[model samples]
Target: MKALVLAGGSGTRLRPITHTSAKQLVPVANKPVLFYGLEAIAEAGIHDVGIVVGETHAEIEAAVGDGSRFGLRVTYLRQEAPLGLAHAVLIARDYLGEDDFVMYLGDNFIVGGISDLVSSFEQDRPTARIMLTRVADPAQFGVAELDRNGRVVGLEEKPEVPKSDLALVGVFLFTAAAHEAVVELKPSWRGELEITDALQWLIDEGHRVEATVISGYWKDTGNVTDMLEANRLVLESVESRLDGEVDAASDLIGRVVVEEGASVTRSRIVGPVIVGAGTRVSNSYVGPFTSIGANCAIIDSEVEYSIILPKASISGARRIEASLIGHYAEVTPAPDTPKAHRLVLGDHSKVQISS
Candidate 1:
């Protein structure tokens, strides 16, 4: 079996940041989100891999050249336009010929990996197998309805009124039979050939379609909030190590990792947190669930539950929390002014002022 990773999409939700960088390359715990998926594929023992890339193909190629670093031989397949998930499979037919393959979304984060799921698919050889998870907002995702016997009987893409609360996770397993289903599918009302439609076609044709409900953590890191949450989740598991220099004036508390070449002076870092390589934290407070990327500088500020990208700086700010700061950005105190209110008086003007 081979692996197909979909790394092509314009991440409009993460604007400004995605405007400059690929969404899949966004870091979670200082590691790109795409790297996790690549590691999982390598762990599954699938070395012949194909990556589907869009116009931002160069960035993906530069990061994952030849895939030899990840123990996989990669073939890059370009998609001129992101028509849909089914369209990706349609274009990758030659690379995926005759072999069963697993499709993983590059920006999706699935904790505990997919080794077990791949093992199960290889054993049963279903026409298609989809991972499902119970979500409160089923309308936001492709939903599935199961019969009384726990068999998937119906599927819909972003339905207005979902029949079930089970939402489709980003991982999919498909056999060679799925190629025929892709050809038979028509574009949806949205003008894109959704993968959900292809799986539905397989079911309509009496081909075996299975669903595996995942109990582990899974997140589609499409927006800023989810990305920060993913960063926190991964950082929570990091082991504390003092690989960098710390002055006697600095105090470290609980599970903090200071990477090599990083320096901390006249600051207090309360962990479960990480200070990336070459980053400097001085005269500041580094609180929990915060990750400072490589070569950043934090001075005279207090930050908690935030992610600061590389080469960024935060100074003279009192406090910042739950923020996703972009690369090379700067945050400093606003210029101060007199406290007294200034108002221009007019003839017979009615006004109320609070003291």
Candidate 2:
């Protein structure tokens, strides 16, 4: 089977950051979110992969070139616009050809991988198979309605009143039969061809649409809260490895990974935390679930549950929690004499002030 990975959405939700960097490229634990999906696809033993890319195609290509590094031969398919999932399939018709394939949303993070899902699809050979998980806000995702017998009976895209709380996960398995349904779809109210509509079309045409309700962790990683949660979840599995230099005055606690060339001096790091290569943590308290990217500087500050991008620096800040700092950004305390708040924020920026 082949794979189709969608890396092409303009992440408006993660604005400012997404304005400069692709949302899929956002680091969770110092690794890009899209890389996790690629690794999962490779683990599923699908080597022939097609990546659907949009305006940020150049960056995606640069990050994942040739795909050989990930044990797959990737072919980049250009999507001229931010259409819809069904539209992506429509454009990838040539690349997908007649082969059965899996469609993975690059921004989605799923624990336990998709190996079992691929194996099940290969054995059952359903016309289409969708992964579903119970979500608190069903209206924010494409939801499915199951019959009394637990069969998929209806599907809707971001319904005002969802029929069920079972939201569609980003992973999908489909046979060549899905192509016919995709071509016949009309634009939804949002002016894009919805994948849920195509699946409903397949169901109406008497094709078997299988649904699996997954119990494992699944997150979209589209917003800050979800990204931080995903980072925390992934950090839980990290093992303690200290290759970098740690001073005698510093204390390294459970499950911390200090990459080579990183240095910790007179600081307290409470894991699960990762200090990326060439980073320095001095006279600071690096708390749990925090990822400091390469070449960053953390001094005289207290940080917890945050992601610091590469080249970012935080010094003399009393407390930093549940935050996402961008690349090359700096965080410092305001002058006591002025006692004023100064922020040079971008569009769609949301800041919370604590007095």
Candidate 3:
């Protein structure tokens, strides 16, 4: 079996950040979300992989060259536009010839990888298998309605009136039968060949389109909230390792991993936090659930539950929490001066000034 990973979305939801970087490359615990997927695929023993690349193709290609880093031979399939999921399979037809394959969405974070999912599919040899999870807002996802026997009865893509709370997780297993279904598909209302539609066609044709509702943690880290949440979850299992220098003035609390060359002086770091290599945290409070990327400087600042990208600097900032600072960004307090009122007041508006 092969693996097809989609790393080609515009990631409009991540906005300004996505404008500068590929969404799949966004770090969760200083590791690209797509890297985790590739690692998982390799762990599943799928060495021949196809990565569907889109607008950010160059970035994706540069990061994952030849896939040797992940112990896989990666074939990059370029999609000119942000077409639907089935469209990815359509483009990867050559790479994914008649063999069974697993399709993984690049930006999705699945805790405890998809090794078992792949194992089950290989053992049972389902015609088509989908991973589903109960979500609060089924309307926001491709939902599946299962029969009383827990068989997949119907599937809808971002339905206005969802029939079930079981939302399609980003991992899917498919055999040669799915290719036949995709060949006959017409573009959906979104002008894209949604994978959900292809699966629905398979269901109509009496194919064994199976669904497994996994209880493990899974998140589509498309937006800032989800990104931070995924980061928090990944940091849960971080083991305490201090390869860097922690001075006597610094207090390192639980489960903190200070990478080699990182220095902590006159600061307090409460963990599940990771200070990346060459980073220096001086006279600051680096709190829990934070991943400070490589070579960053956090001087005289208080940051917690935030991700500071590589080379970013935070100095004299009072507090920063639940934030995602981009690379080479700066966070510092405003200049202090004598208090005075300087305003162009609106008409008939109340005003107050501190002197």
Candidate 4:
């Protein structure tokens, strides 16, 4: 079987950052989210892969290259617009050919890869298989309604009135039979060919469509909150390793990884934290669940549960928590000498002043 990974979506939810970078390329634990999916596909023994890319195709190509880095031969499929998931399958028809394939969303993070899922699909050989997880807001995702026997009976895409809390996870297994369903689909109300519709079509036509309600950790890292949470979860399993310099003045607590060329002086780093290669942390407090990207500088600041992208600097900042700082960004204290209030307020804008 092959793999089709979708890496093309204008991530409006992660604006300003996504404005400059592809959402899939956003780092979790200093590794690109897209890389995780690719690695998982490789681990599943799928050597032939096709990556669906959009406007950031060049960037994705540069980052992934020939995919040899992930032990897979990747073919890049260009999607001109942000069409629906079904449309991605439609465009990848040529690359997918007659083989069964797995469709994975690049920004989604699933703990303990999809090897078992692939194994099950190979064994059971269902026409289409979807992974579902119980979510708080089913309306935010494609939801599946199972019958009394836990068989998938109904599927809806972002329904206003959801029939079930089982939301579709980003991983899907499909045989070549799915091509017949996707081709017969019409654009949904949202002006895109929904994948949920394709699966529904298979069910309507007497094809075997299966669903698995997964209890494992899965996250669609589309927004900032989810990104930070996924980073925290990944960091939890990190082992303590010090390949870089940690001066006597520094105190490194549990499970901290100071990567090669990184230096820590007069700083205190708590557990499950990773300081990327060439990063410098001096006179700072690096708390838990933090991943500081390569070449970053943190001086006289305190940061926790945050992701500091490559080349970003946080100096003299009081504290930062649960934040996603973009690459090459700077976080420094404002000028203290000019403490007087300045007014350039906009209409209907609310401001809080410390008096």
Candidate 5:
């Protein structure tokens, strides 16, 4: 079986960051989200992989290269436009050819990987298998409805009135049978051929469609809140290691990993924090669940629960919290000025002044 990774999305939700960089390349614990999916695929023992890319094709290609870095041989399939998930499969037909394949969304994060799911699918050889997870907001995702026997009886894409709380996780297993389903289905009202529709077609035609309700952690890291949450989740498992230099004036608290060439002086870093290689943290407070990316500088600042990307500089800021700072960005206090309240007096208006 081969692996098909869908890395070609507009990523409209993560804009202005997406405007500059590919969403799949966004780092979680200093590792690109796409890299995690690729590594998982390699670990699953599938080396012949195809990556579907969009207009940001050059960037994706540059980052992944021949995929040998991850111990896999890659083939890049370009999609001129991101019509839909089904469209991705439609274009990748040649690369996927008669073999069963697993489709993983590039921006999604699954903590434990999908090796088990792939193993189960290979054993049973279902026409199509989807991973489902109970989500609080089923309306935000493609939801599935199961019958009395736990069979996938219905599928809906972002339904206004969801029939179940079981949302579709980003990982899917499909046999050669799915290629016919994609061709037979028509585009949805949204003008895109959604993969949900293709699965629904299989369900309507009495094909064997299976579902696995995931109990492990899974997140679609599309927006800032989910991105930060994923960062926190990945960091929680980090082991404590001080591979870098630390001055006597610096105090390290809980679990922290200071990579080689990183230095901490007169700063206090609490547990579950990572100071990337070549980074310098001086006279600062690095609190929990914060990942400072490689070669960054944090001076005279207090940051917590934030993801600072590579080469960023944060100095003289009072406090930074719950933020996703992009690469090479600078976070510093604004020029100090007097605080005053100015009002334009209007006719027949009453105003009070406090001094």
Candidate 6:
């Protein structure tokens, strides 16, 4: 079996950050969300992989070059535009030729890997297999309706009134039969070919379309909140390690990882927290679920439950939590004049001013 990883698409939801970087490349616990997917694919024993990339192709390629590092031989399939999932399938027809493959969404985070799902598909040989999870907002995702006997009966794409809460997770397994369905699919009302439509067509033709309802954690890390949540989830599994220098005045509480070359002086850190390589935290409080990236500086500030990307710095700030700081960004105290709120926010960015 092979793998097709979709790393393309304009992540408008994570704007400002996505404006400069691919959403899949955004770090969760200092690791790219896409890298987790790649590792999962490798763990599934699928070495022949095809990555679908779009405008941010250069960035993705630079990070995942040759795929040898991940135990896979990768061939990139370029999509001209951010069409749709079905469109991605259509473009990857050549690379995925006649092979049963798994399509993994780069921005999605599944707690447990898809090894069991792949094994099941290999044994049963279903025409297509989709991962489903009960979501609160099924209307926002492609949903599935199952019969009483646990059979997938229908599929819907962002329904106004969803028939079920079984939202489609971002992992899919498909035989070569899915190619014809994708080729025959028409554009949806949103001017894009929908994968749900292709799966529906498979059902109509009496081909076995199986559904695996995942009970484990599944999150589509498309927005800042989801990203931070994913970072926290991954950090939960991080073991305690202290390779870096910590002053006697500093207090380390709980499971914290201070990478080599990192320094914490006269500060307090509550984990699950990680101070990346060459990072320095002085006279500050790095609270739980916070990931301070490489070469960052945190002084006289208090930050918690946030992701600080590489080269970012925070100083003299009272507190920051549940935030996603981008690369090379700085979070310092604003000028003491005027006591007014100042924010330059991106589209879809949310801020709750606690004044």
**RMSD in order of candidates:** 7.4, 2.9, 6.1, 4.5, 7.0, 2.9
Clashes of each: 0, 0, 0, 0, 0, 0
lDDT assessment of candidate 4: 0.89
Alpha-carbon lDDT, every model: 0.87, 0.91, 0.87, 0.89, 0.88, 0.89
Candidate 2 Cα outliers beyond 4 Å, as residue runs: 336-355
Displacement of residue 265 (Cα, Å) in model 6 is 0.6
* lDDT at position 12, candidate 1: 82
Candidate 6's C-alpha runs over 4 A off are 335-355
Candidate 6 has a TM-score of: 0.95
| Cα-lDDT of candidate 6 | 0.89
lDDT of 4 by residue, 1-355 (tens): 9999999999888876787789999899999999999999999999999999999999999999999999999999999998899999999999899999999999999998999999999999989999999999999999999999887888999999999999999999999998999999999999999999999999999988888889999999998889999999999999999999999999998999999999999999998999999999999999999999999999988889988788888777667778788877776666543322322211122333222
Worst lDDT window (10 residues) for model 1?
A: 339-348
- Kindly list the per-residue Cα lDDT of model 6 for residues 126-150, writing each as its tens digit: 8999999999999999999999978
Candidate 1, residues 170-205, lDDT tens digits: the string is 999999998998999888988899999999888999
Candidate 4 residue pairs in backbone clash: none
Clash pairs for candidate 2: none
Clashes of 2: 0
Candidate 1's C-alpha runs over 4 A off are 336-355
Q: What is the alpha-carbon lDDT of model 5 when measured against the actual structure?
A: 0.88
Off by over 4 Å in 3: 335-355
Q: Candidate 6: deviation at residue 318, Å?
A: 0.4
Q: What's model 1's overall lDDT? A: 0.87
